[model samples]
Target: MTPRYSLSQIVLHWAVAVLVPIQYWTGGSIERTHHAVHMGLSPDPWDVIQHQIHNYAGIAIGALMVARLTLRIFDRGVLRISARGPVDRLAQAMHFAFYAAVIAQAAMGFVASYFWFGIGSFHVLGSRVILGLLALHIAAAAWHTFVWRDETVDRMIIPRRTSS
Candidate 1:
């Protein structure tokens, strides 16, 4: 049976998806509360804890992305969803955009970590760009899943069936 994604691909996809959100949540909380805490505006400990989570999660996500891309380039298990028509083609385009955006965002996060946040705070230009792209990506996925009633999202998340 042909798999929608090789075991490795599926694993990486889900892993990265799960990690990205954690990183985003932590990073965003830190960004919002950092200045306030420094200025004694808020005494919530959420900022410090979230910042650590963000930093660790970012590193893990970045590493996972590298592995995912490497597998994509080197292995044949990753398949772009097969398009049935113009609308499917459009969906495929959007999916491709999501993949590209994620990679770019991860790269930016890595660079930003080194350049801006000093590798500890997890502040990076990439995180901001990632937030915007993630918003767009999620919106597109929702539109495809609910509004368009397309299988694009399912094909990625669910295993595909094969004919004998």
Candidate 2:
């Protein structure tokens, strides 16, 4: 039988999925707030709220990544492919890269917020890298769903209980 992710894992995965986009959407607001602060002027009320959302959501994402990684390391029920192949290896690599990228981005955002060292451009570049990774990840899922006819998407979308 194919191993499937546990219900708790599925929930965490989706939670991060939801928050990632929120971070992207609020990315611009952070810049605006940063600009105002550096300019020695009060930030616009709406920009401040958006900036807060970005900060909190980013922190949440970082925390969630920690939880997700901890579960991944300790959980015995995570999906495991029985057969090893090139595609399988690629998929595994992509997942690892994504996990690392997200965690780093979150930490970077926090540190940058407090002590930005004119690295705003670097942050923007990192965000773009994340976007590219996300797009590839989604593409991979779609490929698994359609081309491979694998249940990869289904696994994350609808988890099933395993018998003890």
Candidate 3:
């Protein structure tokens, strides 16, 4: 039987998942708007809209990450599919990396926008790290689904109707 994530877990996971891409897709627009406003020029309306989405979505991701972590702490007996091996350790490390990268990236975005601090430079690196982490995560999921023939992905995708 495949273990399934809690419904709250699944919902929060997909919510943040959906918002992360919005941040990436609209990232450029925020930069353009920032520069345009700084240079005493009128920013494009579309850029402004995209920038707003980028900002709000970033906040949403940060909030969702926090909520996910909190829910994880309280989500005892939740179904986890791991082999208790080196792969499991690596997976844990990857998950930690994801949490740190995303939280820091969002924090730096807030600081860089609201303050004169020099942390803006690092946010770009954080974004690239996020991209790398995301790629690795997707690859692992694909491996689990196809190469490994594991039903691990099913846990998040499908909820078991019968209670464990």
Q: Best lDDT goes to which candidate?
A: 2
Query: Candidate 2 on 1-164: residue-level lDDT in tens?
Result: 44578788799899999999998888899878878999999999999998889989999999998888887878777665444889888888888788898888888888887787466677778888899999999999888889989778887877768687
lDDT of 3 by residue, 1-164 (tens): 66677887788889989999998899899678979988999999999999888878888898888777777667675665365899988988898788888988888887876784478679878999999999999999999989999887888888656555
Cα displacement (angstroms), candidate 2, residue 105, comes to 0.4
Q: Model 1 over residues 1-164: C-alpha lDDT tens digits?
A: 33476667767878988998787567667556667867978746877778677767777776777787787667755775568999768766765665665666665556555566454333355566567767877888898789989665675677555345
Which residue runs does candidate 3 get wrong by more than 4 Å?
80-83, 160-164
In candidate 2, position 67 carries an lDDT of 83
Model 2 error, position 111 (Å): 0.8
Estimate the TM-score for candidate 2: 0.91
Worst 10 residues of 1 by lDDT: 117-126
User: How are the candidates ranked when ordered by lDDT, highest leading?
Assistant: 2, 3, 1
Q: lDDT values of the candidates?
A: 0.68, 0.84, 0.83
TM-score per prediction, in order, is 0.63, 0.91, 0.90
Model 2 lDDT on a 0 to 1 scale: 0.84
Clashes found in each candidate (C-alpha, N, C closer than 3 A): 0, 0, 0
User: Which portions of model 1 miss their true places by more than 4 Å?
Assistant: 1-3, 28-46, 81-101, 111-125, 160-164
